[model samples]
Every structure is written in structure tokens, then in C-alpha cells.
Target: MTSILQVLIDAFALGSLYALSALAIGLVFGIMRLINFAQGDLITIGGYALIVPSSQMVAELFIGDWPWVAMVPAIVAICVAAALLTERIAFRPIRDADPATLLITSFAVSFFIQNLILLVYTGRPKAAGIFPGLSQSVTLAEGLTVPGIQLVTSAVAIVLLAGLAFFLKRTRTGTEMRAVAEDFTMARLLGVRSNRVIMLAFALAGALAGTVAVLLVAQTGVLDFRMGVFLAVYAFFATVLGGMNSLVGAAVGGYVVGGLSVVLQAFLPDDLRPYRDAFLFGIVILLLLWRPQGLVVGKAGRERV
Candidate 1:
């Protein structure tokens, strides 16, 4: 029973991180009909923002040294700025382009940021000591122990999810965003400013990415240029699996993917452990085949033109 409880806790914690990543991707997809693959790089940038730029392998703490109160917001702000800048410079001009073009543009932006990181930080991984204390194990029972970071991650996910729900349902700007997501043309006709809503979506997505970066750094204690790649990929999968058009579906898909990952890791044999992701993806593929629309279907489909 204790072992089962431990697994559940671990799964929830891991799922929380994936959920945030999914939410970030889903937000942009909802508003722009463009999957911003560069979001992963934005997350990478967020992690890199904490340390002073150096070619050396060891990272020096810059923002990481600040008090949590200030450090968190600083990281989030930097990511938001980066997201908005990309929207203005790389995406806005081509806003009406084909979805394929927008996708390729995202890839271009992603690679550009990645190479830029390599130039500044070099190809080596850097050791980051962001909130090292969170790495410690917390005892919940005689035999059940969970990492402090796991608890914090889950708590943060819950708070952010609730806060986002309230914002979307209650605020004027949030309603405008929802309208825009449902039908960009109609929203514009209704006086919803496209640029404003799109920019806000990017900002919110970036904030989520920044938060993930912080949690990831705290969890891993290392920095790599590709740190956000797999997370973003998984989140993308979660978004699709949950239903691309529904934010709630995206969030739910994140937990499902996260839970599956943990369960596979725990149950797979030693020889098969290396192929856990392969198996998990296979399951996801089957699920998608069974229900192509995803776990949750959106009420109305909007054509992007």
C-alpha cells in the first residue's frame, strides 16, 4: 500500500511538470493555430537566464543567487520578453502564412536560439545549484519518502491551474482570448484585437515555460541546451492526446502522459527499460487511433484562414 502511494505521489509530481508544458503549448496553439516549437528554446533560455554567460563548463549563479521572491519573477519576465520579441519579429509578419510555413518558422527560431545558446554557453552541460535544498527527500511515512521538489511542483501546478481557470472564466481579457481561440475571424469582427490577444497568449505561455525551467533546473541541478526539447515534445503529445482545441484536455493529457511514463519506468524489465518511451508512445498511438478527436472534444471547430 505504501509503495502504491509512493508511486502515485511520484506520478503526480512528474505529471505536474508535463501539464505545465502542455498548457504552454496549448495556449499558443489555441490562439495562433501555430505550434511554437521555439517554446522549448524559450524554456532553455529561461534556464540559461539564471546564470552569467560564460564559455566555461561551470555556470556561475547570477539570478539564481537572488531571493526566490525576486528570482522567480525575473526568470518569468525574461522568458515573456523573449516570447513577445519572437512573436513580433518572427511570427507577426507571417501571421497569415500557411500553417506549414509557420511551423517551419518555429523550427527555424528554435534552431537559431539553440545555436545561440551553444555559442554563449558552449556545448557542455553546466552544473546549476538552484535551490539545492529541494533535492532532499521528504519523509511522509515510515516507508514512503518523496522528494521535496515533487511536493512543491505539484502544489505549484495546482495553484497555477486554478488561477488560470479563474482568469479565463472571469476576466475580460481572458474572455477575449477564448473568443479569439474559437474563431479568429469572428473574434476580430467582434472587436477582439488579434495582436493583443495573441501577444497575451504568448506571454502567458512563456511564463509557464519559465516556471517549468525553474522547476527543471531545481530538479536536475544541471543545464543543457537541449534541456527543454523532450519536455516540449512530450507536452506536444499531451496537447494532441488531450484534444488540441481544449485547454482542459491539454492539461489532462499531460498528467496521463506523465503517469504512463512513471508507470512504464517502474514496471518495465531491465532490458526493456531503455525502450519505455517507445512503448508509451505505442500506447498513445493506439489511443489516438481509437479516438482521433482526443480524450476531450471541443464544442466547435474553427477554420483558420
Candidate 2:
């Protein structure tokens, strides 16, 4: 029982991280029919923003040295700025382009950010002592222990999810965003400012990415140029698994993916552990085959009469 409980806790924590990332991706996809692959780069930017740029392997804390109250908001702000800038410079001009074009543009932006980081920070990973105290383990029961970071991650996810729900349901801007997502053309005709709504979605997505970056760096204490890649990939899959058209589905999908990953890691033989992702994805493929539309089927896209 204890062992099972431990597994469940671990799964939930990891799932929370994936859920946050998936929500980020889902937000942008909801507003624009574009799959912003560069969302990962925004996360990477958030992590890198914490430390002073250096070619040396060890990263010196810059914004990271500030109190958490100030530090987190600063990182989020930086990512939001980056997201908005990308929208304005890279995406806005080509807003009416086909989905394929938008996807390619996102890839281009991702490569640009990655190479720029390599030029300034080098290819080596940097050790960052971000929120080192969170690494400590906390005892929950006689035989059960949980990492502080995991607990924090779960709590943060819950709060953010609830907060986002309220914002979307209660606020005028949020309503506008929802309308835009449902039918961009109709929404625009009905007085929704296209650029404003789209920019807000990207900004919100960036904030989520920034938050995930902090949680990830706190958990791993290492910064790599590719740190956000796996997270983004998994989140993207989660969005598809849950239902690309629904933000709620994205969140649910994140938890599902996270839970499956933990379960596989625990049950697989030691020798097979290295191939866990392969097996896990194989299972995901099977599941998708069973339910290609996703666990939650979103409403069909509206058509203009």
C-alpha cells in the first residue's frame, strides 16, 4: 500500500508539470490554429533568464538571487515579453498563413533561440542552485516520504488551474478569448479585437511556460539548452491525447501522460528501463488508435453560413 501510494504521489507531481506545459500549448492553439513549436523555446528562455550569461559551465545567479516573490514575476514578465515580441515580429505578419507555414515559422524561431543560447552560454550544461531548499525530502508518514518540490509543484498546478478557470469564465477579456477560439472570423466581426486576443493568449502561454521553467529548474538544478524540449514534446502529445480543441482536455492529458510515464518506470524491468519512453509512446500510439479524437472530444469547429 505504501509503495502504491508513493507511486501515485510521484505520478501526480510529474503530471502536474506536464499539465501546466500542455495548457500553455493549448492556449496558443486555441486562439490561433497554429501549433507553436517554439513554445519550448519560451520555456528555455525563462530558465536561462534566471542566470547571468556566461560561456563558463557554471551559471551565476542573476534574477535567481532575488527573493522568490520578485524573482518569479520577473522571469514570467521576461517570457511574456518574448512571446509578445515573437507574435509581433514573426507571427503577426504571417497571421493569415496556412497552419504549415506557422509551424515552420515556429521551428525557425526555436532554432534561432537555441543557436543564440549556444553562442552566448555555450553547449555545456550549467549547474544552477535554483531554490535549492526545495530539493529536500519531507516525511509524510512513517514509511512515506515526498520531495518538497513535488508537493510545491502539485499545489502550484492546482492554484493556477483554478485561477485560469475563473479568469476564462468570469472576465470580459477571457470571454473574448473564448469567442475568438470558437470562431475567429465571426469573433472578429462581432467586435473582438483579433490582435489583442491573440497576443493575450501568447502572453498567458508564456507565463505558464515561465512558471514551468522555474519548477523544472528547481527540481533538476541544471540548465541545458534543450531542457524544455522533452517537456514541450510531451505536452504537445498530451494536448493531442486530451483533445487539441479543449484546454481542459490538455490539462487532463498532461496528468494522463505523466501517470503513464511513472507507472511504466516503476513496473518495467531494469534492463527495459532504458527503453521506457519507447514503450510508453508505443502505448500512447495504441491508445490514440483506439481514440484518435482524444479522451475528450471537443465541439466541432463552427462554420460560417
Candidate 3:
């Protein structure tokens, strides 16, 4: 029972990270059928934004050294601006392009951000000691212990999810977003300014990515140029598995994927443990074959044009 509880904690923490990441991707994908590969790079930018770009072993904390109240907003603002800028510059011209074109554009954007990181940070991983206070584990019920990170992450995710749900259900901008997600052409015809809606989506995605970066550095204590790339990938899978068009689905998918991963790690034998991803992916493939529509299908679920 204790073991089960521990696994649950682990899963929730991991899921929280993935859920945030997936939401970042899903937000952009919802507005434009384009997956922003640079979403992960936004995360790297947040982590790297912490330290002065250095080739040396010890990284000098940049904004990371600031008080928590200041540091958090700074990261979020920077990344959100970056995201909005990317939409304006890189993606705007190709807004009407086909999925294949958008896919390539996303790849280009990913590479572009990575190259910038390499040029600045020299491709070397740096130790990031952000929010070290969260490292300690707190005792829970019946001798069980949970890492402060796990609790914080889960709470953050839940709060964000609730806030997002409220925004989508109640706010004007949120209504525009849902309208755009439902049918961009129709929404544009119905008085929705496409550019404004798209910009909002990018901003939201950037905020989510920034938050993930903060949590990521706290969890890993290490920063790397490509750190967020796989996270972006998994989050994409989460969106697909949960229901690409549904933000809630993406969130659920993140939890499911994260939970399944911990479960796999716990059950796999020592030798097979290293191949955990392979097995997990195999399961995903088979499941996809069975339910190609995903676990949760959005009302506007069909693949958009």
C-alpha cells in the first residue's frame, strides 16, 4: 500500500510536468493545426534564462538569483514574449500553408532555437539550483513520504487546469480561442480576428512552457540546451492520446502517460528496465491501433484542415 502511494506521487509529479507541456503544445495546435516544436525550446530558454551563458563548469545564476516573486514572473514574461514573437515572425507568413509545410516550419523553428542556445550556452549542461527548499520530502500518512516537489507540482497543475477551464468557459478571449479551435475559417468569418486569437494562443503556450521550465529546473537541478525537446515530444503524444483538439483531454493524457510510465518502471525487471520506453511505446502503438480516436475525443475532435 505504501509502495502504491509512492508510485502515485511519482506519477502525479511527472504527469504534472507532462500535462503542462502538453497544454502548451495543444494550445498552439488548437488554433492552428500546427504543432510548435519550439515549445520545448521555450522551456530550455526558461532554464537557461536562469544562468548567464557560460562554457565554464559553474554557472552564474542570472535572474534565478532574484527573489522568487520576481524570478517567476520574469521567466514567464520572457518566454511568453518569445512565443508571441515567434508566432508573429516565423509562423505568421506560413499561416495558410499545408500541414506538411507547417511541420517543416516547426522543425525549422526548433532547430533555430536550439542553434541559438548552442551559440550562447555552448551545448554544455549546467547545474541549476533553483528553489532548493523544495527538495526535502515531507512525511505523509502511515510512514509514507512524498517529495515537496511532487506535491507542489501536482497542486500547480490542478490549479492551472481549473483556471484554464474557467477561462475557456467564461472569458471573452477564451471564447475566441475555442471558436478559433473549432473552425478557424468560420471563426474569422464570425468577427473573430484570427491574428489576435492566434497571438493569445501563443502567449498562453509560452506561459505554460515557462512554468514547466521552472518546475523542470527544480526537479532536475540540471540545465541543458535540448532538455525540453523530448518533453515537447511526449507532450505531443499526450495531446494525441488524450484527444488533440481537447485541452482537457491533453491534460488527462499527460496524467495517463506519466502514470503508466511509473507503473512500468515499478514492474519491469532489472534488465528490461532500460527498455521501458520501448515497451511503453509499443503499448501506446497497440492502443492507438485499437482506439485511433484516442482516450478522450473532443467535440471538435476531427483532424482540422
Candidate 4:
């Protein structure tokens, strides 16, 4: 029972990271219907943003003897900038293309960004400035163990998800965002600044990915050049499973995939672990076959204005 409980707790934590990445994917798809393959590279960008800073100001606050209130703003600012720049440079030019063309362009952008990173930074992994306590575990009553970082990750994820839900449902910008998502050309024709909304979407993606970068770096205590590739693939699967156009669906899909992956690893035999991807792919195939639209294809229709 303790083992099962531990698995469940761990799954929740892992799910949070997946959900954050998936949220970015879902948002872009919702607005443009274009799969931004470059989304994952932004994660690498976020990781590098947190890594290459020589001052270590944010790192100091996280590890400081005093409260860490100031770190939040700094982190948010860096992430938002990274996101907006990515949009301005990579996505803006291809805005008018068909889905296939945009997707290919996204792939090209992903490689170009990654190569730029490779040219600038060593291909080696670097240690994050976080404390060693992040990986430490605590045992609850009846011998269930949980990692401290996991709890922190889960808390941040829950807060972000709640705030995003509120932003989408209550704000005027959110209403305009929805309008753009429903029909970008029509929305533009109706006086909505589609470019601005699209850029905002990219900014949001960067912010979310940046948050995930910090969490991942904090949890793993290492930063690598190639970290984003794996995460991007996971986010892709999660978004597809949940529903590309549905933010809620992406969040749910992320957790589901995370939980299932962890549980399978924990319970499956050694030989079977190698087949995990195949099993997961099979599940996704089954889901798609069963429900072509996805778990919850948001309420927004695809009609152009």
C-alpha cells in the first residue's frame, strides 16, 4: 500500500511538468492550428537563460537565508522575453502559410535555434545552482516517501493552471484571444490585432516553458543542451492525447501520460520497460481511433470568423 501511495504521489509531480509543456503546445494549436515544432527548443532557451546568467541573482534568492519573493518576477520576465523573441523571429514570417508549410518551418526554426545554442554553449551538461536538498526525500506516516522538489513542482503547476484558467475565462484579452483562435483571418478582419494576439500566445508559451525549465533544472540539478528535445516529444504526445485545441485537455493529457509512464516504469518487469514507448504509442493510437477529435476538443469552433 505504501508503495502504491508513493507511486501515486510521484506520478502527480511528474504530471505537473508534462502539463506545463503541453499547455504551450495546446495554446499555439488553439490559436493558429499550427504545430510549433520549435516549442521544445524554447525550453532549451529557457534552460540556457537560467544557466548562463553570471550574477546568479535568482539562484541566490532561491537559496538565500531570507524569503524568496523577488525571484518570481525575475523568472517571469526572462521567460516572457525568450517567448516573445522566438515568436517575432521564427513564427511571424510563416503566419500566412498552410499547416504543412508552417509545421515544416517550425521544424527548421527548431534546428536553427538549437544549432545556435550549440555554437554558443558547450554541448556538455552544467550543474544548476540549486541546493542539494531538492532531491532529498521525506517519509510520511506508514512509510510513504516523497521528494521535496516534487511537491514544489506540483504546487507551482497547480497555481499556474489555476491562474491560466482565470486569465482565459475572465479577462478581455482572453476574450480576444479566444476570438483569434476561433478564426484568425476573420478576427483580423473584425479589427482584432491578430499579430499582437499571436505574439502574446508565443510569450505565454515561453513563460510556461521557462517555468518548466526552472522546475526541471531544480529537480534534476543539471542543465544540458539537449534537454528540450525529450520534453518536446513528451509534450507533443500529451497534446495529441488530450486534444490540440483544448487547454484543459492538454493539462489533463499531460498528467495522464506522466502518471501512466511512471506507473509503468515502477510496475513493469525489466524486459517490459523497453517496450514502454510502444505501449504508450499503442494507447495513443487507440485513443485516436476511438475519439478522433481528442479527449475534450475545446468549445471553440474552427470556422474562420
lDDT of 2 at 159: 99
Q: How would you encode candidate 1's per-residue C-alpha lDDT over 1-305 as one tens digit per residue?
A: 89889888988999999999999999999999999899898899999999986465556788999999999999999999999999999999999999999999999999999999998888899888788889899999999989999999999999999999999989999999999888889999998999999999999999999999999999998899999988999999999999898899999999999999998998799999999999999999998999888898764442421
Give the clashing residue pairs of candidate 1, or none.
Answer: none
- lDDT, candidate 4, 1-305, per-residue tens: 88898889888999999999999988888888878878788777766665443343222223222233654445656768867886788678877888999888888888887888776666767665554587888777668778888989999999999999899889988888988887677888989988888888888888888788878877886767778778888888989888877899999999988998888889888999999878877877898899777787776632321
Give the winner by lDDT: 1
lDDT: the better of candidates 1 and 4: 1
- Tens-place lDDT per residue, model 2, 223-303, is 899898889999999999998888899999999999999999998999999999998799889989998878876553323
* Count of backbone collisions within predicted model 1: 0
The deviation in Å at residue 292 for candidate 3 is 0.3
Alpha-carbon shift of residue 23 in model 1 (angstroms): 0.7
Cα lDDT for residue 248, candidate 3: 87
**Model 4 stretches with alpha carbons more than 4 Å out:** 53-72, 301-305
TM-score of 1: 0.97
Models 1 onward score TM values of 0.97, 0.96, 0.96, 0.90
lDDT of each: 0.92, 0.91, 0.88, 0.79
What tens digits encode model 3's per-residue C-alpha lDDT throughout 1-305?
A: 99999998999999999999998888899889888888999998888888874566446888988998999999999899989888998899989999989989889988999998887777878888888889998999887988798898999999999999999989998998999998888998999999888998999999998899999999899988899999988898888888888888899989888988899999899999999999878887887888788887776876542
TM-score of 2: 0.96
RMSD of each: 1.8, 1.9, 1.8, 3.5
Q: What is the lDDT of residue 24 in candidate 3?
A: 85
